[model samples]
Target chain A: MIVDSLPRTTLTEIAGMAGGGAALPALAARLNIVEMTQAAEDAVLQPKDAGRWPHALRAALAARIARQNDCPALADRYAGMAGADMAVADPAVAGEAEGLTLVCRFMDKVSVSPRDVAARDILELQEAGVSDADIVRLCELNAFVSYQVRVIAGLRLMAESVA
Target chain B: MNDVIHKFTRNVPDWRPRVTPVKLEDATPEQLDALQVTPSNTKVSAYVLTLAHDVETLKVRSPLFNGIMYDPGGLDRAARELSALAASVLSRCVYCAAVHAARHAQLSKSTEVTDDLFANGDKADLTPRDRAIFDLAYGLAGSPPAATPDQMRAARDAGLSDAEIVDAILSSALFGWANRLMHVLGDPVRKGAA
Candidate 1:
């Protein structure tokens, strides 16, 4: 349904995905648009289930750490725990989780300039004592010279660790 | 480390597709600069200038033309959705990943979905249709050559229409060029800025 409504660019993109129309357009065009639209509209109107798998993913991650301890079974069992809703009680955990969610959510949007280096590299460089100012300077100079941001960031990290 | 290599992969070339880095900075004064390459008899600076023009076109056309095209008008959302589309492209873009990731979250109106996006681009909490959109974008952005017939079958099974599918390809291609420029020229002005 949503597919029916999207413009040609998006459609072409989707078509391109199926391996460029000469191959897949016949099948894609044959899809039942009317039925699909109804299903999507209904889905959007329904209420959401908040306490879902996000925390479960984290728990599973946490469980891996906990497994080294004596209570492996208990740790593993707890790892499967579902993520609680933000509206539910525990303010502190909720607050931190919310913040983390925002960071992650923010990541979903913009296409970062691949020219810049990884942030992890910058963070590491900072740890090694290369000032933030120098890192910023490098980024600017590299921009002018058309240097890769990833390399620049990596160098900063290396410089910091060495410094 | 090979920062330049890190920024551009075989799928995407540097700003001047034909020009090498050494050629860009070291060519004689009479020789054309990297930014100067363009089709003859045109004032445009080839790749970079073309992008600047198209981005403006996308902005205006998205509102006027694409507005009427989609029933509810998804172009703004589409632009906003470009963030999500971008996240999938920026794996090589250390500078771009977080920015697009953040925009993806804002469009979805949920932190949870956004986080899921970074953890997994196509597998994020998008609707089936949108997922189809993401998958299409991913295939185009990642490996245009290998994006074979079977890949389109997957999208069809996922429920993208012929038209929507076409749009998805255009969006991905637009990003293909857009991502390269941003990667090369430096947009978002900051690593984390969405």
Candidate 2:
């Protein structure tokens, strides 16, 4: 929806620029995005998480995501992976493009019609007895920030227990 | 609503509210005044970081959400107003809903869309773009599991970019947090109901 409303040429140009493929290696090297990605996958998939490996790995990922403003496409790839679709449902290269396209559409709609109730959401969590500080900390979770609405809501629940 | 409600129950073992539903005429001016404010306890930092992400989303990723938060060059103001409207309604925050409803009227040369957003939640007759946004708001506010691959694909078919989609998701997530805060603090004051 948001995508449809945007200038097609702009989307094309952006896609083309990203597809030039120069940024991937740079991104992979700069943040160890590739290694981090692997580590994250292992941490999530393996047992005995006990919150150690996952915590360290997430901290690493969060750092990279914080710098997402510099290279949105790369950020898009990583954030998108973390957000909704982690990898192409189909293994084909075209599937990745299609997946990216789907992510783009979803993001456009959200960006356009964002929820402006940060104050209220926090209050609800706190009214439920979550602490003010913990509420703030939960909001810092990049997964919650990047489109994981359930994760955000879950964070509120998690915060309630800790707070 | 039930899931969020359940989440609260599971999290707060000792939490109990000081509920006091005052009648309109009996309510103190202070209570009514507080309704208009975002509240000191509301997490401002969370709001700021999410807004910053939204700015980056628009500037580098997609034009759809580029100017929603701030507008120097003036772009997407109407759409932003629409977003604000959707955000408030889904949030069920009386204060935010009223404010953004007025904003939608001021920005648009019409009131039909705003009216729809008020009367209907995600079922409003909006453009494909706004519709997608509405869907996101509902998912973010109510049940996020509803944001399945189908929902994602619908937006994609409608032409959204990866950047824009991520922005939208972040925005929805941000507001979801915001709405919960507002609701927990207190309901908003109606235009002149107090």
Among the numbered candidates, top lDDT falls to 2
> Model 1: residues >4 Å from true position, as ranges?
A1-163, B1-91, B94-100, B121-128, B187-194
| Candidate 2 lDDT tens digits, B1-194 | 11122111101122122122233344235433322224464332222322222221212222222222342322245554454455556645554455556666767777788777666656778888777656654554543324545555555566654434434543454444344333443334322322
| Top of the candidates by DockQ | 2
- The model with the greatest TM-score is 2
- Give the deviation of candidate 1 from the true structure as CA RMSD: 21.5
CA lDDT, candidate 1, residue B176:
40
RMSD of each: 21.5, 16.4
Give the fraction of native contacts in model 2: 0.06
Model 2 achieves a DockQ score of: 0.07
Per-residue lDDT for A1-163 in model 1, tens only? 2232322321223223223323233223423322232232122112121122234433432232223222244233434452443221121232244434322221212222333434454455446554433333222222211111111121122222221
Q: Write the per-residue lDDT of candidate 1 for residues B1-194, one digit (tens) a residue.
A: 23233331112223322111223333333233323444573343333332222222222222322222233422235433543354335435533444454555566665665456556645567766556556545554442112344556665676554444544444444344334434433322222222
What C-alpha lDDT do the candidate models reach, one value each?
0.35, 0.37
